[model samples]
Target: MKKRLSAAISSVGLILGTSLFSPAGAQEIDLYVDTVTKQVYTEPGKNRVKMGTFQQVQKGANRQDKKSSDRQAQKKTDQPAQKDSVQQARKDSSQQAQNEPGPAFVHEPLPERPKEEHWYDRMHIRGYTQFRNSTTVSGDKDAVVYWPDRSVGEDTSFLIRRARLILYGDITDNLYLYFQPDFASTPSGSTTGNFGQLRDAYADISFDDKKEFRVRLGQSKIPFSFENMQSSQNRLALDRADGINTCCRDERDIGAFFYWVPAEIRERFRELVANNLKGSGDYGVFAFGVYNGQGANRVELNNDMHMVARVTYPYQFSNGQIFEAGVEALHGRFVTSNGPVNGITPVMVAPAKGFVDERVAVHAVLYPQPFGLQAEWNWGRGPQLNGVQRLITESPLTGGYVQATYKYDSGPWGILFPFVKWQYYEGGQKFERNAPKNLVNDWELGVEWQVTKAIELTAVYHMMNRTDVLNAPYERFRADAVRFQVQWNY
Candidate 1:
């Protein structure tokens, strides 16, 4: 009877304890889980727990309490495992979604990248070179006087005038980059080979297909005269501007420019040459902020020009010709060598003292049939240099040019183009018994032959008369030159 009673009491305690210990507290799904751990577990009363370490609870804390403690410890231990399991589930869900798709896609858009980072997205490359040999039968002068060469005068000569390499590309949909390097002839042929001096480095971004709301930054072409912007890689003539004012170097500045292009054409442009622009390829308005104006990769003692602005229009004629026209203004601040009463100081000069360096200009280029013509005119008033006693020119200065070129498209291995250029300019200090009115006029005859994609040959004859001088003798300085050149491009 006593044995039976003890057995019955033991059975009751066992039942009660078993009922209280619930595996539901583990609260897990989909596993034959043992509920063991990959991490340490702190019992209901224990301190901080660390992963992959062992922990134990004291004995006789109710012994029953110990069992409960172990279960509670399991819940804590599973916290991290729960996180890992959740991640795995998500990954699986995503894969399933991809497999069941009617064209899988992401809801979020991709991030945009800078132009420099996406250089090859939209890229274009081009390059050219010219060489020539000429037999001279003329007067006893050399190349343009500014750059005198005694190597060959009125006699025959062989030369390489242009050896060039160019790289141009676009980034994203609207940004662009362009570079040109002249490796052929140096400023003095071999005497000065300025390799890798960037010919052009600028980032361009535009709003749309019409290219409105555009910005260009870095070292780029100065929006100035026609000759200054024309590319040397392909000048229709052997000699540009009769080599009078055609160094065309210093035609760039390190700066940023803002521009707006128009979508429509105008009547005046159509009438002028079927189609014309402001020397700008499209109709637009432009404003520039130049940091250093003495071209790119150069250092100057004086400050650079502050602003250059222009309004322009283009015309597309029914005859398949194009023309452009524009008006522009400029304002610059600088310190002149003429000033600084003391050596340690810098005295600023007033650029607008005598006249408005403000200028009015008009340009037109015509492409009709076998002939092409381009012309520009500029008239502006400028500050006269202050003499020890002020003596300035009475009126603003005027300068311009009218140029024509005739080209015959490629036939066999060569293309022939003959061109003529004429210019007239006068702007100088009148104060000096030495300073006088200035003008330059030139005439050239030349032809080019392409020997290969990378090689070109050229031959030419030129004559020039320069009238800009400080008490220049005999009204003008004249020259006659004969040249031939050969070049390689890479």
Candidate 2:
């Protein structure tokens, strides 16, 4: 009986432990045992006696809770370091992304840049204006003299010598364009003044990227004289020497010209003009061209085209001084118009066709690096009025000038250029009405002050002896004058 009781109690403990002790939240339980019936009960009732409280000890659950707490504490302790490690990993990833190309799946497209402006938008509009005044300080004021700037003659008041507007641009890698118009032109025989006239209309087509080889086309200055090639705005003297100026009036004609220069030399030419050195810009180291024999603004009178060629070079010495020398020649026929006899009625004095108009010239220049010298001479045959026969004939002509100049930099005040020139010319002024014969011996002393980049002032004193181009009776006279000019650039 004792053995059976012990076995039954062991069986009950095993069953209860298996069912209750392993519950999720189970701990202890209270039970009442019926002593009369020998049965187990959870509550007290009839014939039930208090057995004892039983504790369901869950060893695995206690162990699991302790382990969970320990794990939580460990997590709290390591959280900062783990966070820093994660941040480091992200930083490295970002750095690597920058150094290498993005993955194909990333599908990131770079931003596009804006398009450049058009060539026309890049064109430049620039120009300069000159206002001049002249008075006969001495000599015969009534004498007739041909001054390139007509405003320099006696009885002339303040006038606009040149009012120009220049438009220029590089249209492409191999093409350039330049156009200029003057608003101060006076029409022949027209009383109205300030007529607008085209000065330069040309295009430079380059055969290479460097523009070392190029062709210029349209109405442009003829590569005849160095002084003629130099822009009037940049010339130190008020007027060009009659010797060279008489060859091509206005120094321009409609032509197609080919020019050649080394690329390095071309850059030096640009620097010369950019540095305010009195450079003729770049006609070329060598040039050849053909043009209508008629002068600028004149209608071509014949089928023949005039041929011209020039060769020039600028040499730089070890001391940084630049000197240039050139020779040029042109062959062509020139026709002249008749003027009124004694300022009354016009008549045909020139031949029905034209006269042999040709010339050869040589020039030298020592650029004004504090001190400078320039000279040019030309010999040609053109239609000239015979004073004795009272008829026009092709006559031999020769003329030239020598000039010296000094450049003084005045610091903030400005720059000063003092110059003196002497000229003599015996030629036919073909462009004049009668193609008058002229005898010229002149002296000019001038000083130019560059007040600023945009403004300049010049004063010149002149002593002149020349034939009167307007007087049909072949009058020769002498005159002295003082001229002043103010120029503005933009």
Best prediction by lDDT = 2
Residue 375 displacement (Å), model 1: 1.1
Q: Give lDDT tens digits, candidate 1, residues 180-208.
A: 76664354224544344466678888878
Candidate 2 error regions (>4 Å): 1-116, 340-352
Give Cα-based local distance difference scores for all models: 0.49, 0.81
What CA RMSD would you report for each candidate? 17.4, 20.2
The window of 10 residues in a row where model 1 has the poorest summed lDDT is 31-40
Least well predicted 10-residue stretch by lDDT in candidate 2: 99-108
lDDT of 2 by residue, 1-490 (tens): 4543453365356435533433333333445554544444444665556777654455586776866655465655544554454344335433433443323342336899898879898689999999998888778887746557677676688999999999999998888999999999998777778999998999999999889999999999999989999998999898898889988868999999999999878988888788888899999999999999788988998877888999999999999999999999999888887656655443435455688889999999999998999999999899887765356788899999999999899999999999999999998888887688888999999999999989999999988888777657668888888889999999
> For model 2, what is the error of residue 34's alpha carbon versus the real structure, in angstroms, after optimal superposition?
73
List clashing residue pairs in candidate 2. none
Local error of candidate 1 at residue 458 (angstroms)? 4.0
